[model samples]
Target: MGITHRGTTRRVRAALSAAVVICAVTAAVPAAATAAANATDAVRGPTVAVGGLDVGVERISVATDEGYGAASITPDGRSVVFRSLKDVAGSGGNEVYVHDRSAGRTRTEPIVEGWTPAISGDGRQVAATTPAQGMSTQRIRQHSLDLGILPFGCGRCNEPSLSADGRHLAFGVVDYISHNRRVLVADRDGGYQTIAYLGSGAPARPSISGDGRHVAYQDRAYQKEGVYLWDRTTGTTSGPLEGPDTYASLVQLSDDGGKVVYLSGSDTYVHDVASGTTQRVPDVKGVAIDPTGRHLLYAPHGTGGPSLVLRDLRTGTDKTVSDQPATAEVDSVSADGRDVVFQSAADGIVPGDTNGKPDVFVRRLF
Candidate 1:
C-alpha cells in the first residue's frame, strides 16, 4: 500500500492549480518521459549530485504467485523472508517464505498468517505480525531463527520493526475499543511494555534506528497527522519534521539514527537530525535508504508501469533499472543494502484467475 499523506488533499489542490498553468502544454507528454526528464533536472540540487549513479535490475524471481506481500532481508543480504498465500500445505492463509541467495533455494515456513517481516540486524531473530483468528487480538511475534518458536508476543501489534542491535523491537497497536493507536516497545525476550502512546489517534508504522537509540512513527494527533521522532536516551519527542499539517509515511531512521528518510507530498526527503537540515529528492515515491545511509532507492508514482530507481547520497545521480511497470511498490530493503525487493503482479487484477498473482521480486544493487 502507498503511504497516506494527511492534509495532502489541499496540497494536491494547490499543486494542480499551479501545475495546470505551468505545464499546461507539457501535460500531453507521457508520464515516464516527463518524470525521467524532470527527475534529471530536479536531482541537480546542491544536496544531491548532478549525475553519477547507476541502477539496474539484477534479477527477477517468482513470476507466478498470488498474494505475495511484505518482505525483509537479513543483515548479510544473503536471504529474504516474505509473506505469500501460495499454500504449499494447502492452507488458505499467508505464511512466511525464506529465499537463500547463497544456496539458490527457496523454502516456506508457517509463521501463522503473518506479514511485514523484519529481521534483526544480526539476522538471528525475525519479527512479524500475525492477525488473531476470528475476533481475537492480533499479535506481534518474535521468533528466533535458530530456535523456530515464538519467544514473545505483543497484543494488537502490527508493522513490526527491529533495532540493529536486536535488543529492542517496535510495533504499533491500537486500543480495543477506542481504536487509537500507540507505539509499543518490548525486549526480545517477550516482555510486553508501552514505550510511547498517542491517544485518540492511529499510529500505524513504526521504525527503529539501527543503533536502537531512536524511533520514528506515524501518528495522528489533534486535527493533524504527522511523523515524530523519539529520542530513547533523552525521552523526548522531536517536533513533526514534515510539518504539522502534512503527513509523512514510511518513516525510516538511518542505520546510525543520524538521518530520517520519509515520503512526504509524493516525494522523499532526508532530514538530518543533528544539522536540522532537509534535502528533497524530487519525482520519487516509496523510498528505501541503505543501512550505510549513502544510497536511496525509490519508485516513481502514477506511472502506468512499474519502475525502480536508485540515487547515491554523496552524489545526487539517479538511474532507472527496469522499464516494465511494477504492480506493487518497493517494500523492504536488505541489511547489507544491496538488494531491493517488492511484490508485482503479472496482469491487472482479474477475478477467479490466479495466473496474474502477486509474486516477490528482488533486485541486487550493482
Candidate 2:
C-alpha cells in the first residue's frame, strides 16, 4: 500500500475497523478492474532492486521482485505469479512475471501488458487479464507462458479467477453504460455461459471452488448485499446464507463447496451451507480459508493496522504470522493452508525490503 506524495511514492498503509458495517445495497459495485493502459510512454523511472529479499525465519519467503504487486501462489507453493510496472517501466506498459522458488529464476510472460494473475491447482497453468485491442475492457488469458497454448478469450472481462484444476474461468463483464454486471463461467477452450445476472444482486467478484462446481460471490442488492452461491450442476443460486443482516462478501469456500467463509461487516464468519450453522471468527477481517474450510488466514480489524493471523478450525486458536508496524494486505492461502501469501510494506518481515514499496511474501503455517 504505497501512497503517492508530491511526485514519489512511499509506503503508507491505512484501513478502518468497522464496529458496524451495513450493506451498500444495489449501489455496491465491484471495485474498478485493474487498469493496464500505458500511462507513461516516455518518462524514465527509478530502478528497483530486484532480488535477494528472502531472509528470515525459514517459514517466511519473499515471492517476487521488490516492487511487484498483485501476486498469487500456486496450489503446490512451488511458484508465484505477479504483475509489475517495472517490465514496462516509464512506458506505462505492464508485464507479468513468474518466479520459480526452487530454481531461483524469474521468467517474464511474453504478453505486452498484463495484470491480476491466478494459478491453477497443479501449478501448471495461469489465468490473467490482458487489455483487449481497443482497450475498453480487459480480456482473459490462460496459458503456461512460452509452452503449450495461452488463449485470449473473453473481452470486457473483470478480475478473472481460476478454478483449482485451471480448467474453468469465472469473472465479471459489465455493461459500459448502465454498469449492469454479469458473472460468467467458461472452459479453458472458450464459450462462456452466464452463471448469474444482476437484479436482485450485484456481484463484485465470483470465485469457483477447487472442484469447480460451485461459484461464490458477494451479492450487492438493495435489500441485503450479502453472499451468494451458485450451482453449475443444478443451474440454481442460493444465499445471503442467513447469518447477519449486514453486508456479506464471499472470501473463501471449501473444496467440497459445503462450507463458506465470508465477511459480514468487518467481522469474519464461517457458514455451513448444509447444517445451517454460522461461526463468528473471534476477531478478524479480509480472510482467506483453505479448501477444507478448517484453516483461515485473516487480518485483525482492531487497534492500528492489523497483522495477518492464522487460525485452526479444529483448535480455534489464532496465531499472528506477521506482526509489523506497517500492516499486511492478506491475500490467498494454499489449498492445505500451509502457505499464506500477501503484499506488505512492512520492513523486517524479510531482509532487503528497502525499496520502500509493498512486495509479496508467503508465510508457511507449519
Candidate 3:
C-alpha cells in the first residue's frame, strides 16, 4: 500500500523521507504528455536497462506534465491503484487508475474525483477520499474494480484505509469546532466504532490489519505524541511508544497487525504488538511492509546515490533495489517483497524515459 499523510489528499512533491534521510531525492519536475485517460491498453513502456541482472523493471505511468502522483499495490501484487493528473475522457483533474499486471491492462476507476487511494489485499476493492462538495467535511467512498461503487457511509472522514479482506474500512475524523479528532473502523455491514480519540490534534493515518482487529494510528494529544495500536478483540490501546522525540506517525501495519512501522524524530521504528518490543531502523526512511512484516522497503542514502533498499527485519540484511543516480520514492512493495512500485524523475531507470518527469516504475527483484 502507498503511504499517504493524514489530512492530505494529494501527493506532495517533496519527499517524505527527506526530513531524516540524507540521500532522499529532490522534488520531481513536471512534464506534459497526452495519453488516453480511459485507455485499457496494455501498459508497455521502456524495458529494463540492459543488464544481466535477474530483475525486471517496468514503467506503469505515462510521462505526463502533471504534478506529483502516488501509487499503491495490493497484497497479491497483481494490481496497482494510483492517482494521476493524466487527462481523462471528460475529467480535467486528478484521476484514479487501476493497473492489472496479470491482465496487462490499465483502466480508470468509476469515480475519478478521489485521491489517497487504498487497495484491498485481493485487489478487488479500493477506498479513496473526496472533498464533500459545498460542505466543509470530506467523504470516503469505496469502489469495486469489477462492480461500480460499494456502500460506504464515511461522512466527514479522510485518510481512508482498508483491511486486507476489504471487509473493514478505517479513517480519521476531525471535529473542527471542538478540535478533537478520532479514528474509526467501519465494517461492510455499516457498523463502526471509534478506536482512538484525541482531545486536540489529528490522529492521522489509520492502518488496519487484514482481519480488521487491529488499528495503528498517529496520536498527537497533549504530552503524548507517538504511534498507538488499538486491538478490537482485547479492547485495549497500547503505548505512546516513545520515539526519538515526542512526534511519531504510523508508516505501515503488518497484515496480522502484530507489527507497526512508524516514524519519529526523523527515524523509523517497528513495534511488535505481541512482544512489546521496538526495533529502530537506523538511517533509513521506512515505506511499506510486506504481508509477513519481516521485510521493509525503505530509502537509504548509498554511495551510488539515493536508492530504495529492502531490509530484512530478522537478519539486518539490505538489498539495493532501485540503484539509480537520482533518488526514488518507495511507493508500495509486494507481499513477498519481490515487486516494488516507486516514482522517480531520474533518467535511464528505463530506456526512453526522456520526458524529464517523474514516472511510476515497478522493479521485480525476484
Best by lDDT: 3
Candidate 3 residue-wise lDDT at 320: 68
- For model 1, name the residue pairs that clash: 49-316, 305-325, 306-325, 306-326
Assess candidate 1 and give its lDDT. Answer: 0.57
Q: What is candidate 2's CA lDDT for residue 328?
A: 34
Estimate the overall C-alpha local distance difference test score of candidate 2: 0.58
Report the lDDT tens digits of candidate 3 across residue range 200-266: 6464788888888877877777776777777777666666665756577778788767778987766
Full ranking by lDDT: 3, 2, 1
What's the TM for model 1?
A: 0.73
Kindly list the per-residue Cα lDDT of model 2 for residues 102-176, writing each as its tens digit.
Answer: 554455554534546766655556666666667455666555533423544445766666676666667777766
Q: Model 2, residue 268: displacement in angstroms?
A: 0.7
TM-score sort, best first? 3, 2, 1
Evaluation by TM-score, superior candidate among 1 and 2: 2
Residue 197, candidate 3: alpha-carbon lDDT: 67
Model 1 collision count: 4
Q: Least accurate stretch of 10 residues (summed lDDT) in model 1? A: 14-23
Evaluated at residue 157, the lDDT of candidate 3 is: 73
